[model samples]
Target: MTVLHEKLRGKDTGYWIIQCTNPLTHKRTTIRRNPKTDAKFKTKRSAQEFELQFLKSSMDLNMKFSGLFEDYCNYLEVHKSGKSLIDMKSRYNRFFVHLKNKKIVNIRESDMNLIVRDMQSNGYHSSYINTIITTMKILMNFAVKKGYINNNPIANYPKLKVAKTNDDLKFWTPEQMKQVIESIPEVYKTAPDVRQIQHIIRFGYFTGMRYGEIRALRWKDIDFNNNIININNHISKHNTERAGRKNGDYHQLVMDDDTRAVLTEIYENHKKQPEFTNDCYVFHSATRGPYFPLAATTGNKYMMKLAEANGLKHITFHGLRHSHASYLISIVGLSEAEVADRLGDTVAVTSKTYAKFFNQARVRAANKISSHKLGF
Candidate 1:
């Protein structure tokens, strides 16, 4: 039932009355709303949405968000890696705490919008908010599957639109990389204690490896004869070595001249010290333990500081991998399969990620072929 008040006591007044009955339980519910305060519940369209959501949530007192989210986390634990589970648990602690005790049916599109606004206003990136929403939606959809709720009300509401094209990617050009590297103080580049930072940066650009994968590297993992650098594991945020890369399999980066030269420099620097062994981390942080790789934060912090000081564009540590992929696709013009082999993704996945670059390549190819003169 919908009712709109036109007047009260001869003064102009407008408000909405939402009334509904539970089909399953024969329970009556009514909500009176003033458009001035509750914008989400003001219009007839949104009033009906509120009616449906409130009725569903009121019907079942036990379908709580906390309980359902815990169930979802249990499901994720069995499927996701430990590190990934920890990350999600952190998100739960940080952002999802407020939603914990609410009914599953109570979560709404408007609520999600509020969350997006709050996160954005608090300086959270769209990508980071995307992850939070993705995790939340996974729980909501799972609730629907388990019959905990009638349906996910927020299902149709799309996420914050994020730019996905090459122009939006934050990769650095080859020249920018050179400028940032060269701007480093000479002593920082020469001293073994600090040189690891520069070496790690160069190594990441030379071979498109994730910071975790690069940090986890061992001299023994490198096979000079086979021309392969095996990526089999990573150093977790907790400083413990974990097995298997993010892609869930062993990947190899074939050694090109640049990669070989970078490795040669790293090895020469390491062999000068007595602790150097095939078992040692390839990028060791002397400030920490010689046995431990640079804590993921160290490299990231250095990059931020270096960027601020040098007037260089802040290419995130992960952007090094993007730089490598962009260089391979747009500069070297490698096939998708070739890039995938180096990047450790399937060709289809790689093509979708770098679709803008691939599209440009197609245009260039067509133009080059069409330039051939055909005399009639």
Candidate 2:
């Protein structure tokens, strides 16, 4: 292979030229650089090493810091369709604000440590610190491939050790569930708008659907004949300075009979209304569109009010999902695999996080067997 012509331009003070042929295609290519602006290389051998490094990086999946971050956000936007790019952009902006006026290549391990220390001083928990560090590592790895930096400074940073606090895994008992359902006001039951909201809560307890999935439900995804509810979508709220925007799309999940019944009832009721006959959303607000998934703060506020009114202890709406899973394992005596399948979680997750609930059920079963043996 013949080397391409090398143009030794400038005052021989900073710049150099490299000419070489493509290893596979044998095509000739030339690269020009100003060594002063780049990292220093004294000897010809050192220059050759730098040239090889550049060539390798050019062929690999690398990107400049800004470019890599933008690409990463784009990837998240496409793959995580339920999430909005604007939300990611906000997170990126918050992280970048701390890194202003600093080159991506110059970010050192001490810089990350200082950031964590500052956050800790402001009373942020270690978990939140871990999230920031993980995000930084992802961005750094992307920069490494682009040849912006030779190494990831935060790659080996120690994770914050967090101790387990109170096992606040509270769930509604069968009696409590009955009481809550029976306590629904007659006015809410009669009102078409409020009735569906109540049903949404009940369905969440019965089927363990996430808040986003419940809001995004459509009449088309339900099958009354087969008693199947296809949980392929979620509604996400994109908060802004103005009114928040709501978006929905398909996602993976699990479903059951009670969920289907609640959906069918809601669907049939909506079908009877002339204005809602062709409407696409299952749970629309008074504004003639699907209800935006409630923000975490707003949802928690309403949940607390509901708990207070019903004379129940405060629990998150997400607690309803946990309650359902707990009931399946404890009262229903379902295996971990069965519970995991119904709850749309892996068996490992079911066993690791929820296995303790099953222990109580097992003890109860053993006691019953012992009583039979003793003829009592």
| Residue-level lDDT tens digits of model 1 in 136-181 | 7887888776555777887777777776666556777888888777
- Per-prediction TM-score, please? 0.61, 0.54
lDDT of 2: 0.64
Give the C-alpha miss distance for residue 262 in model 2, angstroms.
2.5
Candidate 1 residue spans exceeding 4 A from truth: 1-113, 117-125, 130-168, 186-194
Per-candidate count of clashing residue pairs (backbone under 3 Å): 0, 4
Q: TM-score of predicted model 2?
A: 0.54
Model 2, C-alpha of 39: deviation from truth (Å) = 28
- List clashing residue pairs in candidate 1: none
- lDDT at residue 335 of model 1 (Cα atoms): 90
Q: Let me know the TM-score candidate 1 reaches against the reference structure.
A: 0.61
Report, for every candidate in turn, its global Cα lDDT versus the true structure.
0.75, 0.64
